[model samples]
Target: MAEVTTSPRTWSPAAAPPHAPHSGGPRWRVVVGSYGFRLTLVVLLALAAAVGILTYGNPAAPGSSGFWVIVRSRFASVGTILVVAFCQGVATVVFHTVTNNRILTPSILGFDALYRVIQTALVFLFGAGTLAATDGLGKIALQSLLMVGFASLLYGWLFTGTKANLHLLLLVGVVLGMGFGSLSTFMQRLLTPSEFDILSARLFGNISASDASYLPWGALVCVVVGTVLWRRRHVLDVVALGRETATSLGVRHQREVLLTLVLVAVLISVSTSMVGPMTFFGFVVAMLTYQVVGDSRHTRTLPMVAAVACATLLGAYFVLRHVFYAAGLVSVIIELAGGLVFLVHLLRKGLR
Candidate 1:
């Protein structure tokens, strides 16, 4: 038998002092400690090894002399994947955090659609051959800048409002994406079959031989935009808590959100321009990262986890394409897998 006695002072909640900071944890603990980060890091490291295998251990290359060729090709492919992964991951995470919803991707907000519209209009205004002949780097830069300008305009309205509701903002974004899609479709219908074929390929986010030439410019844009997002990672943590809560905590919520939106647009535009439109990659990466990390703070969790996931997926695709498939558009396969995940996520959300 135990005898229990409590003093009146101890029983009073108000009399208790603030909780002391916790200790006795691992001295070299990884910050964020999300399962997503650990898994992503593992996946990315494995992917790097896999790329090494693909580049150096190919049997088809009859001689050791072909290693450099394999290296060059793999280098281009990995570089492009890194850019796309960073662009899509950062953009999707920031966009969802700003809007306070997990279901929405940057594409839902007309980012990808806007890119298509610009591309289509350019082809329509200039003949396809002339457009093709244009400097690829210049096009990527100009396109990204245009996207940033458009994103800034679109988000400016939200800053005027007192609060932004998640569902409402998603509704508006979906509607706008739909509008842009419809306009792109209408424009495509007016083109010749050959021209429409070109448009169709562009619309689906194709990363084929014809599109590889845009890589250098796309890489540059991705690096610039990725740096911008990295600089604002701390601000992202505050923005995730919704507008009012963030503002109450002395964050310049609107300005920061708008700037993030523009950065996201730049990132999306660069990546989309590189490979085409990836409708669900970001949604998949970001949602998985959130679920994996169990924290919304962008500071420790956003770039590291998101970038790793993106790189792993793309790297896996490269391995499969070189090692197994060898005859398909890797982007199509990834988009299909990503779309399925998005649907499952939506169904789960609906059930909840």
Candidate 2:
């Protein structure tokens, strides 16, 4: 006993060294590594693309008054891009969530068909002059109202019963889309060549075609809708876990789906009415977003989707406009690329 106590050991708690927690432990986590890096990289690239588009090949010096004037003129295109990208990106992601299907896009919900019908009918009944004459807030509001109303009615009716089914809703949407397309085609066939030419321009999705006056209103809707979605990200996360899980988590799954569809309809409507129907743009954005985000959680997924969309659009716009001098084909090129990607995805992964 005396020999054992010879060292006179100090057993004070303060004398012990502290242990460091594992870096991978939840208690010690900081950054999200690639998730954060990719997101930040995308955002920076988007900013750079925007700067280039606004400043590149300016006729006047950067500090000159003429340069500022040119930039101001170009700001409309940039604003249009922002509004369209935001609307499409947000709408596509949320649409995927509600349907629990990544392959489907808001375009398939008949917005494009409805938009085409509206434009074609305008030209068919009142002639091509009405297309230009109808370009105002009133027309846009009317278009958005019709689209959203259609969605609300469809969702409300479909999700009302105990056997409320998403696939059935999708089937019905497809059938209706085909019908609308047929109607549009018939109307176009009856129109004169000159009328068809004007109608064709409206049919193609053109970012530059978006009226400057419509940008603010579109952006306002996006801001309000985006605010709602972002604030409810957690709830969306639960909803993404599927209906049973969401209901168990105290969320009203049916109500949420209806609400999400209605909001998505608004977004798609605004973008479609502003820039014509972007059939494959949102599909490609959502597909690429799903591949990049690496997480199903809406919190991380949503922002990443938005950044990727902005970067994609801005980079493509800058290149096609400045480099290729094919500014008018930006939408065409995007749709082509999107279609290729869609076909590839279908061949490889099917409809999951």
Candidate 3:
């Protein structure tokens, strides 16, 4: 054999090949290493704690009727919280993915404004007492139908071209939303203080205001719509790549976008009908979700988004209800906090 003189192994650190990136690591390990997993754990623990504190204990005897009643009510409130979180979190994430805009949410599509208009019109036409006496299920159904109908019409008409004018659709939505908002304000201004107060209560996203009666229907809608979105999550990832890319990748870009907006409209209808308009709650949760997950894949990000939203709602509800005993202020506090975060994010982006 020819003198197999192995070249002396390089001992210098500079001569050593760089360590391979851990991209080929076990899937589970990669998942564990990601922020999404850790944050999910934290969120779950916080949610459990919140549920425990909110539902456990009773002034009455443990197994007494009063105790069970209290437990039932707390459970209902928790259910509302979870439902709202799901609708807002999922809707916002999907909306942003489809629109390819991080700053915009379904609220910008006029769902919230439409909700306010319906609510205001209800109060304006029929007295608040009549509105209150209206069947909860009926109200949710009507609201959902109206919203879904309007969105379908708007999107159906605008998205009819070979290339959907998403910008035009968005512009039209913005204009419509502004019009609805203006109408609502005008109606609100015309109302008596008492009526305004009632309408105002309905406007804010308050958990306590949520109807237990609406829970079953709302939960059903959420499950169905959420399942649809979850199943199409990968498609959503493609959609997020923008219309041309998604089209190039064999995605029915316009159709998928239309479907997503319709789903978003349904979700918004459920959540808005259930807990009133949470204009910025979805934005806040979606932003925090992206920050925590650090990934664009819907499968990874959506669950974390739901978790964060749940944790936020539960934690806020717990602290306000248990610690501060100001449960009524939960929505106000959330909106205020979310708005502040939005402003800060905008400022940071501006500075950068």
lDDT of 3: 0.86
The local distance difference test score of each candidate is: 0.70, 0.89, 0.86
Q: On residues 102-161, what C-alpha lDDT tens digit does candidate 3 reach at each position?
A: 888788889889998998998888877767888478878988899999999999999997
For lDDT, candidate 1 versus 3, the one ahead is 3
Candidate 1 residue spans exceeding 4 A from truth: 1-63, 157-172, 208-224, 326-328
Query: What's each prediction's TM-score?
Result: 0.79, 0.91, 0.88
Please provide, for model 1 over 72-185, each residue's C-alpha lDDT reduced to its tens digit, 9 standing for 90 to 100.
665656666766777787778788878777777888777778888887887787856655676476776787788777767667765567674445555777888888889877
Candidate 1, residue 332: CA error in Å?
A: 1.2
Q: In what order do the candidates fall by lDDT, top score first?
A: 2, 3, 1
Which is superior by TM-score, 2 or 3?
2
State how far residue 329 of model 1 sits from its true place (Å): 2.0
On a 0 to 100 scale, what is the lDDT of residue 37 in model 1?
53
Per-candidate RMSD vs. true structure?
8.5, 4.1, 4.8
Q: Candidate 2 residues 1-352, lDDT tens each?
A: 4555456687876676554334356433445456887899889999999999999999998889999999988888999998899899989999889888877988888899999999999999898999888789999999999999998899889889898888888999999999999999999999999999999998998876667888789889989999999998998999999999999989999888888888899999999888888888888888888888878888988898888889999999999999999988999999999999988988888555
